[model samples]
Target: MLPSNTLPNPAILARPRRRRSPMTLGAAFGLVLALVGGGAWLATRTPIVNLGNEQQLSDSGLLQAWKDGAVIVMIRHAERCDAAPGPCLAEPDGITVAGSQAAQRVGQGLHELGLNGADLLSSPKLRTRQTAHFILGQALASADWLGTCDPQFPAEAMAHKRPGHNLVLVTHNGCIDHFARQQHVPGGERASGYASALFVSLDGSGKARILGRLNEPDWQRVLASSGR
Candidate 1:
């Protein structure tokens, strides 16, 4: 404690208190983004958008892309039997019974989206095959690469994507993750859940546009909101 104001220094009294500069909006935003998901916001590639809500989906241009037959929809197979407690749909290697029901619902949603000109395919794995059957109401062509989860997945997807038709692929989680990675999705981001779908548009000549992702249960909400 200084001598109780015995004689305050005139210089001290005349000195102004220094004020700290407030953080800039950009800096604050960068900080927040970093804390939550690193530099994904600043990344040049488009970040994976979650179309779980009405606002996001409505503005995502997903419907128009679907109508134009320029989208490739990747769907992760539903719950696996060995990993899930539920009874298997048929074999221990296949998806669970409940998963089949979920797959059915997803299929209905795609049907509502009008699969008339859509090309549906699945991985050769048992789980994916079973899921594809449930979603498509029949067995479809099995592509070995769908189960490969290769580094060339992005190219393969574009190669399979028809110029005038939507391509619906029922595959594995790793395969979906690989696709998301190609979209520049951060590894810290959450993986696609069972029966979840990621929509990508081949709008550009060479660059693929990442439309958005839709979870299994949000199909009804997305469809209901689109009013298409």
Candidate 2:
């Protein structure tokens, strides 16, 4: 006969092990994703202006947005055929035929975008004035307030514009880029032309912020990538 061996308690054998909860792990992962996605949305989302086609900046769209408040659009002088960065030799105007054509394109685009009410301003330089004329369809008086190259000009025109006015400034690439740096917008390092529009937003707090940049090449892409 075998000796009776004490068997391990049945209660101990039946006791359940303390395993990790799969639901808890899933919840933690979901929380992480939510936080990451929210941050990405905020990082990419900016107040920069929309540079999309007519459908985007229509009268009922971006233009109206400015009309409700102050909207400033700054552009570098149009494309110049001059091999070197100097005044044009053939004409007193620094702008060439190509540049003139580009200016016309800008005018047409502005008209389509319903910015006819835009208060156009320009640099005193010949090229800048000529570009402005093409868009405004008339020789406009140079604004000492708008010329960036001129040392006497105001430090910042956007801050100086009176209440209830929309300003579109035609100036050199350098000045536009400088303002872009002050506002912290991208792509100011490269020379651009024509339908490029850099839009900034200044809240009631009196701080000018880089809202958005709309270039001719990827105007729509900027909008789409922004997820707005």
Candidate 3:
């Protein structure tokens, strides 16, 4: 048998590891803090939408509303350069080629939804006008109110709703955000990306209620659902 003093004790081998040094612990904590800080920064940079408690309309519902002339669709213009916002009317750096194609697809989707005799209006900006033309296969009326991010613009547009005709406005992200805030749209809603549509329903009293937002992918889903 081995001598007790010479042999290593099994209990000693089974002992828990020693606690790390304070400097090492602090470095680890700081790394965690850095990672958490990065995540928060990313969240702040990301755009978020709040749909609130409003009922979201399905694809069929939206199509029916369009047919009933009770739908008001507000869509942001397709992709543009990352340059500073300026008068797109006078500027040449408008929508990218991919943006144009995306607008065409959106237009096709609208046609599939039976966009018959709908009144389409676009911001005076070149990108918006281009999107409207691509979608409708014709020039659209230019609306100065849609060219800016004025919060009152949506309400003003809704006030002039024409019976038996759905209205479509192609504008900017700022304008859409302004309208959403004015309508008290709830949070947890996904932000509309480029070429996305925000569908609203107009009542007999000319009051407009938000239905929900449909992004490019959502449109595809709707199309697929209908086997289109």
Q: Put down candidate 3 lDDT per residue, 162-186, tens digits, no spaces.
A: 8888888898887887777667653
TM-scores of all candidate predictions against the true structure? 0.81, 0.59, 0.67
> Top TM-score: which candidate number?
1
- Model 1 clash tally? 0
For candidate 1, the lDDT comes to 0.87
Q: List the residue pairs that clash in candidate 2.
A: 47-211, 48-211, 48-212
Against the correct fold, how does model 1 do in TM-score? 0.81
Candidate 3 C-alpha RMSD relative to the actual structure:
8.8
lDDT of 2 at 98: 64
Q: Report the Cα lDDT for residue 171, model 3.
A: 87
Candidate 1 vs candidate 2: the TM-score winner is 1
Among residues 3 or more apart in sequence or in different chains, the pairs in candidate 1 whose N, CA or C atoms overlap within 3 Å are none
Off by over 4 Å in 1: 1-41
Top candidate on lDDT is 1
lDDT of 1 by residue, 87-118 (tens): 98888999999999999989888988889889
